[model samples]
Target: MNNKTKSILYGTLASSILLGVYFTVLTLVSGWSFTQ
Candidate 1:
C-alpha cells in the first residue's frame, strides 16, 4: 500500500472512533439527566 492510502485509512478509522465516542458520551449524559 502507498503512504497516502495508508494515511487516509488511518484518518477514516480515527474519525469513526471519535464519532462513536462522542455519541456514547452524549447518550450517557442524556440518560443521567433523565434520571434526575
Candidate 2:
C-alpha cells in the first residue's frame, strides 16, 4: 500500500481504539448500568 493509504488506515484504527477505550473508561468511572 502507499504511504498515504497506510497512514490513513492507521489513523482511523488508532482513533477508533482510542475512542473505544475513552468511552469504556468513562462508563466505568461514572458507574453506568446497562441493565437498568
Candidate 3:
C-alpha cells in the first residue's frame, strides 16, 4: 500500500481501538450492564 493509504488505514484502526477502550472504561466506571 502507498504511504497515504497505509496512514489512513492505520489512523482508522487506531481510532477504532481508542473508541472501544473509551467505551469500555466508561461502562466499567458506571457499572453498566448491557442486559439491563
Candidate 4:
C-alpha cells in the first residue's frame, strides 16, 4: 500500500470512529436506549 492509500485509510477510520462516538454520546444525552 502506498502512502496516499494509507493516509486515506487512516483518515476514514478516524472519521468513522469519531462519528460513532458522537452518535453514542448523543444517544445517551437524549435518553435513548441502545439495548432495545
For candidate 1, the TM-score is 0.82
Question: In candidate 4, which residue pairs get closer than 3 Å at backbone N, Cα or C atoms, i.e. clash?
Answer: none
Runs off by more than 4 Å, candidate 3: 33-36
* lDDT, candidate 3, 7-29, per-residue tens: 99999999999999988888888
Q: Is candidate 2 or candidate 4 better by lDDT?
A: 4
Q: Residue-wise lDDT of candidate 2 within 1-23, one digit each (tens)?
A: 99999999999999999999988
Off by over 4 Å in 2: 33-36
Task: Give per-model CA RMSD.
Answer: 4.2, 2.6, 2.3, 2.6
Q: 1-36 in candidate 4: lDDT tens per residue?
A: 999999999999999999999988888877676624
The TM-score leader among the candidates is 3
- The digit string of per-residue lDDT tens for model 1 on 1-36 reads 999999999999999999999878877988766545
RMSD of 1: 4.2
Winner by lDDT between candidate 3 and candidate 1: 1
Taking all chains together, the TM-score of candidate 3 against the true structure is: 0.84
lDDT of each: 0.88, 0.87, 0.87, 0.89
